[model samples]
Target: MFLKSYTGADDARIYHNEGDCVVRYVKEQCNRHPTNWPVEPGTIVAAYAAHTRQTLYLEQKDFCNKNHPLGLGKPGKQPQRSVILPMLTPNNRVLAIMEFDKDETGFKEEKIHYALAYGSWVTAALIRKGIRESLRDAKEYNATILNCLKCFLHEKLTLNQCISAIMITMREFIRAEKVIFYHIIADKKLDADIYEATSYNRDIFTKVSRKIDLRKDFLMKDVAENHVVVNIHKGDEEQDFKKYNITDPAINSVLCVPIGNPKRLLGIVKVINKVDHPMFFDIDLVNVSNAGMYCTSIIFYTAIGKQLDNTITIANKQKVTLTRHMIPCIHDIIQFRSRPITKPPPYYLSFDWYPTKDELSRDLLADYVWWMFNDLFEGDVFMEKFDVFVLMCKKGYRKTSSYHNFEHAFCATHCMFVIVRTCSQKFSYLEQMALMCAMLCHDIDHPGNTNPFLKASEHPLSKLYKFAFLENHHSNVTRILINHCKIFDHLAPDDYKAMVDDMHRLIVATDLAKHFRKKKYLDDLVKDKRFDDSLPAHKMHLKSIIMTTCDLSGQFKPFDRTREITFSLYIELYKEGDWLKSKGLPVHSTLDRTRYLDIPQDQVNFLSMVVIPCVQLLVQMVPVLKDPYTLSCNNLDIWKRVSFSKLFH
Candidate 1:
């Protein structure tokens, strides 16, 4: 309620809050005058509010007459009524005193109550605004950390380099002058070895003494032992600075956040003197404090190793294969007739030409990816990360499939690359990265069987994922493989999470069960020019659509690749059909091996139904992608001829 704010220790009613923050008096009525909200404590409006603890009303005369000195009165206009409201917090603390300067009349009881009701909503909005602002700040803080990591630590990482990058990143993250990383050596001393970042986001400044010998300083050691973060400014808890004379006074404000987990103190990151303010803010405190956690996670990871396992140990009924599924090491880097991808080659021919069982090159795949994304990941990081990623893709995919192997993955990946290259102008670097990675591992660990075969056979994985069994497994396992090796350790947590999550959705969208639904969704989007590239949701939806066409793209390949894969599909389906008969289950007519001639007819049917419609939809979206549609038409023509020949024979 609008009570008379005390002028002194006494209960004297006065309107003297002109210089306050929460409550104040202003000469002008505008939004910027938070420090000077106008006061009318002695008026009838305030008295009525105090008496009722509700909205108070005053007639034009009562508001503008001698009783209210704060009322604004024009020379010729008639005085209007005033509605004084008490804006309160949930705890009933008066946050602000609100007043409608002019109203039609004070006699309308319903209008007064309506304004009072809106005041309650305003209270909730203010509270929620604080919460939203806090969350926005947190997101921005995290983004800073991620940006630093993405920029600095992408390639050829050494311990010193990682530490230096982190030190500089933490410094820039909080806009501090100097960021020092203290290495806790044998619980004795925190040697300040890592470097610093100056203004303009440069890492040039350094201290003469690279070590903080904690054995000599008791006060500094106490702070180290307690594992506490101390942020000290001139008047703000200056005693926090008094306990430790570790930094220079010219530095002014100092924030020391200890880096470690619950187990042990790994190090302490000390940032002295923020650039903008003489004293650090709460946001600065939060950023540096969080930097400790990120530092610990990195230290823990670095301490362990980045040596990626070339194999996944799969335990089965027979035995535990210590290195069951393995991707062979790159004996040599593929010498691509490496040309710049100014535009996509008609249909991924440069990558998948004259494909053979023994001629597949992991290095070739890695090199093409490195080249394609080199713009985004320049320097050594692109080569380093994609080298590991390519191997991980190979290791994750099963060798059981004649088709759907890493070679097919490579082919499919190149299709996605073509799609991305065609549509690259619209996507962000991260979006491109997510889309590329999604294509690379779309069919990881395939059992060389259809989803129905797996479900009917009651394969463990089918029961596990249940719905999009194989597709979900591919998504989960690929993620596990990348995470296990810590492939994207160079990326910030937020970026890594975004890439991983986006890639997962793309991979899951490859499930044929979700295909028609996703296809229709895109078809609808195209029908109404609803494909807004500016919207993230539309971009992601488009990524899903792109992934679906790319996943089944083996059918749209040129004659040689198409023929080889069609025969391989028969081999896989026949294998499933054989397995189904062995289990005494009635095989579906389409999957029955006895109808071998139907493979071409099925190809024709599939082209006429699933494959052609989706590719046509994609062609509608990206008209430059006419090659795949042409290839689909050509494959349909050949498949029809082959089906007719088989029927006659």
Candidate 2:
């Protein structure tokens, strides 16, 4: 006999072996005639089938009752004893198995051990899945925040715009109760002007100004000086929250972060409480502060842009006014006052002569010229008088020429006044004025040409003053005109002679051929520091050099205007060159080639290389000339390079 207990079937069964490990059963089948035993000994198929069906029905009922699949089996209700056996196969081959009561202590212990092992595997897999989900969520949140920041920066938004954007994004993401932006003024006072409060009243700006002492306040000073974000939490014993007026209903907690450049503190930002969380941490403060830094830089740059725009606008307005008023006056004076006299007068022949014009015209010109002189000469009255005389000559020329083609004469007069004003302060008002009048009339009726033309025409004055220095002939012509006029009879003889000598030197210096010679003379005086005592020789040489330089100083004007003047000179020079070439005559050295027509460029280059250096050297030698000479040199260098590059290039 073999015994077997199977958990799947739930019945303990006894198997009787006949032969060759086979089992047989004796029972009746329901569908066949009732029989207790097999009639045929070989095989009772119906009886065996009936027994198998009965066994299967008993097994199913026992399995359900014992195992209690609904977990309703109680220890008290279940059976305690069961046979242990090897289960038999259908062929009666034995297999190892265990049998016990459903509620047996050993069976329960085995079941508990299996359940715990399965639960542990499931729990561990769930925990791993949770951790991966948390990491992925954190990564996505950070990526979203970074993308928002990138868009904000790319827009080139202003400080207010950036701050507003940040507040909106942070409210949506971080969910803060309030955000405040503060800024420090030059006086080191801080004010919280930018405030965004979602849950609280936003009227903090009006209400809080009196409560905050940001400059000397103990709490703010720490954050500002350290340039660090401070995270304040409720019930934190480390700091005195009462002093800051922090209460539960008000601001229970705050994250204070300093706004700044690398060099200095700009201000601070304070974020108060998390909407969902009760406590805020230093990490939250750091996040907000990092965003605030971009806002601070934008504010600073915007301020700078406004300042530059204002400065440029003011400068442009000043330039326009200067061009409209000052330049025309300067032009009129220069064009009508510096020309040679063509006719001789009788009254001024014996004494050195001085030209005179209509009394009313002279007075008008004098007053106008005096106003300009006063503006330029400021403290010097001597130069003002000298300028008046130059104006008188300009007025005289305008009257004689009927005010036509008076520009060169006026320019010459203006240049002569500038030279005398800059040269010396020694001459008395009357003497200087007389000297200026001589200089002006010394070149009246100039014909817009040179001494060569006079020589070519064999003009009577040229014949009489044959081979004389051009400037001396100009002086003689001036004297002749003045001597014939009854208007200058009020002058003294010796005073007139002294004026003539001074005027002679100034007019002669205008000849371009004498430029090197005059420059060399001035350079010698500069090297010797000769102007220290204002000796006659030093004064004379200084005067001569100044007059010469002033005549050529058009190159040192503003670059654009200088170019216009140079273009005019080019036309004049080109015409002269063409005339000489047509006559089959030898051209002057300075005009020997068409290439030299660009003399303005060459002269500007020379000023940079030579004139500026000379002027600087002179300033070092003569301390009194230091400021004016240095300024002149700088102006020349600047205009020369700028004009040359703009025009030639």
Candidate 3:
């Protein structure tokens, strides 16, 4: 009903791209009004257009022709001619594809052009309608949840009834097959209290209420104690079922949320197997978790005769922090075919080389990364997966951050390439690869806040990582992406293990807090003339030192560029400091925005103390590192000379 059109065609269809596949959103018959009929993805003309984001015109010269159309012959009524046009958003994101067919005459060029023009209006209208409908649906859904909570709070519904009703509501919204609630009995056993099923597994629910031994069930125990959600999308159903002691073959995916605050144990809610969607996404997890919070409150009030307002508030805050740190979904995983790039200038490998915006744009960076990757590694498997790995790394970086964005990651990676290229013979191939991966993902998913700020603010990440907080997080994200893309799938077992170990070591070495200690260790090795690449300990020390050098390579860029990068970094740091001050938390002097006037001197001190020392040590180890070392010293002098007032201007 949303899109009603008569194109003098026999039939029409509308397709929407949903995470990796194209699904039919609407279907029409004999130019009648279209109906919203969702269908799984297939190799149809509309799907092909969505995949390629290009228009396709298929003409059947003869009605009885048996040859498959475009090698994609689905069981359907064959039309004499059909044309598919992809509707795209402003950013070229595919919204839908409109397929027009004709039983008698083919679409002329003018009609196709007209359809293209009409698609723009249709896309805008559909987006506006989607926004309005989403808001309306959200409001109604929230009201339904609130009504359930009110019924429970007023004692109009028993605990089981209230929770079961809420579960049904949640399952409906999430379109999940079943929502099961289990009550914890004195920290020893999990007793299923409520089991609500939509379809397909009604018989399994009776058996699903069996008690689970908390001591024996390690996964369930972890969920109850640590308040961690277990979200399994695919490929681990059998193993997860064994842990839960379930035999339901229909459950392909699962999302389990713990229902309690930090102070006490309550229960766990399991949302199993999304109906139509292939996997449970972050939004689904969020919805189930929020419902679990409501259940936690309801169960607590029923037992303790008091509301858990403060605890629930704290739990919500913790959930927000956890979700913020959750792995971001990779929306676009299109294979990147390497293209020819204008070769970098003669000084591209120099420490002072700074790429223009045109040279470092997203597409150009992809090209540069691919070219540089091929130049370094010759493994056929690595070459095949390298494109996806680069795409994942780029997607992992939070572009909203002022300083630690993809641009900075790529620049640091370029600096690492310079080091690896110069010392190709010194470091083994795996070590060089580790260095590149570490630099490329060293600051991924950065919240643009410092470690002290995270600790003082009681962020969930601080609880997860007590030391080298952000570095560990970045390293973890990098590892997840690497595994997700299967970048090293073809490496020998020992080589793969060594690659991961070295990458983790190199990534954590980028932590600035540990810089002084690492610097002193490397300095002692060099001063005592005991530095040897043959010794594992000494080699690790050198790798750690060089990691710090590449991390701070921004300090050695041309003076103006260094100033720009430094200012961007302060912008993020000062913002965190402002938040900390507002929250009455301890703020580091360098992070404090009120001390902006002291920034130039602070930069001078950091470079002289941290940057110069690290680079100097690396230069001693690898004489070719002198270029960046000299640039660092010169930048330090420049920062020392600039007055605070003129520096900002």
Candidate 4:
């Protein structure tokens, strides 16, 4: 835990570079000790004394009064003495408290005042550390803002998008409820009115495309003509809006920052209503004003059909950083929500729990993941971690992919679920968990390109993870998201690590490179009669085969669904092939869009080659799971009649 102190300016609050050991020690001891001590009151009092230039010295006897009774809530060891000395600034305000707490120790009452000298040194050291951290944070934040600004420096965005981007940047920096950018259309004389405005009011942006009376808006006029920023608060907005005869609800605060070259103003950036803080300061003005300059460049370059320079000079590279909430869960993306697969479907052996075509949404898949996990572990008290894990899975398979998307993940999950049911809960809890998670996160963040294309083109992802091709890279990204989100915080350390390893193994096994090796082993295991479900290694081999089968589950669905899946896969492959060929790289024969093969024949080859063999191995291990194997055979028979010109008919 950390507490911030305002050591630089009145509004500039900064925290020390290191954690407050006092809080950590006190809190940890509170949890570990048998003493039912209240920590909050003492911590607050320490901070208060640190802020108000006071010191507190409490002995065990002092706490033996009616409030504490020998400093024991339920008869536990009590601290002999506690000391909190104010670390004060030169102006006599407390910067912080330097506390020393001891159990079964006597304090030198005469030399206790000597601790006052340590308070000054501690205050100075903490303030210095805070300054260094504040500087580093400011540097990093500036670099990030610069990179975010480059996103707006493009010609592809419509004028409205550009305008919205400008206001968004301003509002984020200033923490304002509203931000408006008004373009100053200049006459030949360079005189202009603040017209063509776009405003982000509260949540959504409303395009206010109208000419405003410049004489009535003196703040904008002052900013445009004098090229100076304006900040007004404390009920000043009421009079300004009244002066313009505008009957809208009045804002509490307003800032007008000029945009464009210093010599000539091209636009005005107006921000209003600081949400997090009470008032807008110089820092907010400076940040919004700097961002407005980039907005000007975007507006000018875009209007002329010329690309604005997006080159960033910062050391930090820009990335699409998403928060835990921003990471799209099933709830975030889906239009409808329903829970159809309420209980285990009838005939868990056949496992024909199919949803209507209209019920296909990311929400259903997310809900299904939760429902299945709940069913598998009936006695589990809560599943907040598992719920977040599913959400992260939905988000990990972003919209960039066509075939390797969340829907594909859901299909794979459905197949795995069916197989699990067929096996009659033969798998352990951890094994089932591994299989389900692996199916959901197998193709996360796929780039629509093949391993061969990635390796040939010298992609950074391939180089970073050289062993397992794209599978390892996918596994890498999945782990990164998982660790960043920290969804499995409830698991024990060893259990968490084991589960992560299992998930990684399952995902990496999806690569075809591991398929034949695992298959050869599985073949030998079956031949030697050494395939024991009780053994972890044998279970892993079974899981590998199951993973392979589930990944190719698209080919085992009904004819319409199989055809749809196959077309989507081919489309993605062709797109990759087009990119590879355009880059003057050799393309795989199957993915070559121009050199087209018989469409259904290609799928027939995939099912006959990959799906049939995988399903054969799976059903051989678990004889009851022959339904999916049969379905794959039926789909292959349907695809045998498909031709390129009239495949659907």
Identify the leading candidate in terms of TM-score.
Answer: 3
Candidate 1 or 3, higher lDDT?
Answer: 3
Tens-digit lDDT track for model 3 on 1-649? 2222435656666766663556653325655433222222334555556655777777765322222223222236677777778887664556787877777766667766777888899989977876698678767877998898888878887776777677777788878877776766544434434445435744233224546665556656667768788877556356665766655667778888887665566778888777755457676777787787787677666766534666678767854564444433444343344334445666777768877766856456755666667779865677787777777677777878999988788778888888888889988887888888888888988988888877877888899887988999898777777776688878899999999888888889888878776677778878898888788988888888888887888899998889888988999988988897898878777888889889889998999888888888888988877988899989898888999888767
Q: lDDT scores for all predictions?
A: 0.63, 0.48, 0.73, 0.64
Off by over 4 Å in 2: 1-367, 370-392, 395-424, 452-462, 466-469, 484-492, 512-515, 530-533, 586-600, 605-649
Clash pairs (backbone) in predicted model 4: none
**Cα RMSD (angstroms) for every candidate in the order listed:** 21.3, 29.8, 32.1, 25.7
Better-scoring candidate (TM-score), 1 or 2: 1
Worst 10 residues of 2 by lDDT: 51-60
* TM match of model 1 to true structure: 0.46
User: What clash count does candidate 3 reach?
Assistant: 0
Please give the lDDT score at residue 335 for candidate 4: 26
Which lDDT tens digits does candidate 2 get at residues 335-377? 5345321232333221111234452344343443444344444
lDDT of 1 at 557: 70
Give one digit per residue, the lDDT tens place, for model 4 in 498-559. 88999999999998877976777787778788889788788788888888888888887767
The segments of candidate 4 whose C-alpha lies over 4 angstroms from its true place after superposition are 1-326, 329-354, 361-363, 378-382, 595-597
What TM-score, over all chains together, does every model reach?
0.46, 0.35, 0.51, 0.48
